[model samples]
Target: MEQDIANFMLRAAKFEFFLVNRDTSLVHTKVVGVFTAIIGVNWTKVAQFVEVAFPFNTFDFTNSGFEIFAQTAPQYLVIKHDGRLGWDCDNEPIDSWDRLLTRSYAQLRNNVAHGNKHQMPAPFTHDRTAQFLPAGLALMNFIANQVFLESDWDTPIFS
Candidate 1:
């Protein structure tokens, strides 16, 4: 029931839990290389998914792309809307969909792995940590529905 293979594949692929206590900085800056392993900081896949889900990249980037839209706001919540269109932000995300398409998880990864890693800007502080865990776990299950739920793929992720 532990699903050792599943766990190994998850870890091997470089996906980290980034749990608050153990390795929270993976979400931002200040990471220990050996621990982050292979997954690196490239959220490109997630960003790509976001773009497909919300193609316009038209969300308000007025005050740094760090703003988290309400959970009810599907248009902004799902995609990586940062780095698309902004001037006052601390870092660069892709701009046009075409640019985002070519953007890999480079800056954060490159900085952390190669040169001096700058401290990242402020993080998402809105949600409760308790809520964060279940949501993330649900996301994992969403991707691995077949593997985790077997034929019951339609079952609710958290429920």
Candidate 2:
């Protein structure tokens, strides 16, 4: 389990390198958003393609933007919804993880993939970057530490 999480974090770190090296501005934002959703799919049972099935302690993943774990899959996701904030999955009409993803990373990913790159955070700002990039990276970093105490993830070198 520890090794699996470390491997996942290594991949996530590679993505970070790509983001820092190849992407900038809205492109960077787009990359970050996509990366964020990827992280979501891996962390939660949201998507199955890159699904990471390690022994994750639900207790370690509660709150902090994640829905409280219900057995395995999360019961809900914490994100801004409607004209206000907080939208419960049961009360809303969400057919996919789009509505429940953290910071609407799925939405940004979908929007970019579909060529509707309008209203994006315009890069150079956390609006798009904050949309997920840092949070996802931080989450993965945290999870990595939780999984591997001796991991030197803090001193990442893109090489």
Candidate 3:
């Protein structure tokens, strides 16, 4: 289910890019308004859903998990760590999947919201359509593999 949501988000991002690239007239204030709303509201909602599934709550605030998961990780970890610093120090190295997804999704959202609607970037040449497509697809695959594939809801919640 999480994978499906990520896929849908990727497709939506791609479609928005395609539409803006094909029709300059379509790039009006209204479109930018909608883009801002999507990034600010929709993306955050998706991120929260991802958090519920994966629950990166084993790392400290200084770790990548806290940075990516925000307050949730520290709050959850505190229950087991009991104010001890050794909790994160002793655990096996966890992959920084949440950080990667958070950063990439934020960038994709910014590009959609702020990239010049009237002018295409040099990377996105007049004829080339593949340049910006990878970010969307990569994010989708990352979310699918990291959050959905690895999550075990049957495991006990920390808090």
Candidate 4:
């Protein structure tokens, strides 16, 4: 039942089974907008539940792309030293791949939504954005599952 609901949310989000037939530059650029909207509307709430302050300002991505955001954004999600997925509070010095991907997504969102809106930097090029699409979908799925499992339903979330 939970899995069904998660699938429903993913479908409702318009990213249940995304595929790129042509993988054009236009598709890549447009996907940044889609990701930004979903994250702003859905995933940001999930992050807030975990006490994470998501970066929504263009200045966060203006100076540098992924590198700057990775350094500045809150490292809430990470792989612990024990190889378990947890928060980055222990100062283990190991970078979480999930965190990195999330940072990249945020940077890409800023680049397209606020910047040139046509071409991005090295790591967030059109091809890389195309490649990150699946990972972005997976991240959204993870956020949805976390919300469903963790929320007690005491208060209604508006956004």
Candidate structures ordered by TM-score, highest first = 4, 2, 3, 1
Better of 1 and 3 by TM-score: 3
Computed on alpha carbons, the lDDT of every model, listed in order, comes to 0.32, 0.35, 0.39, 0.35
Estimate the TM-score of every prediction.
Answer: 0.26, 0.29, 0.28, 0.30
Q: What does candidate 2 score on TM?
A: 0.29
Error of 2 at 8 (Å): 15
Candidate 4 lDDT, 105-137, residue by residue in tens: 444343333333133233323244343334444
RMSD of each: 14.4, 13.2, 18.3, 17.2
State the weakest 10-residue window (summed lDDT) of model 3: 70-79
Estimate candidate 2's alpha-carbon lDDT, on a 0 to 1 scale: 0.35
Candidate 2 ranges with C-alpha deviation above 4 Å: 1-11, 15-131
| Candidate 3 ranges with C-alpha deviation above 4 Å | 1-10, 14-41, 57-103, 116-135, 141-159
Please give the lDDT score at residue 140 for candidate 4.
40
lDDT (Cα, tens digit) per residue for candidate 2, span 11-115: 565544443342232121224644732222321222211123333332334554333112112123235545532213344432233233322434333323332
Question: Residue 61 lDDT in model 3?
Answer: 32
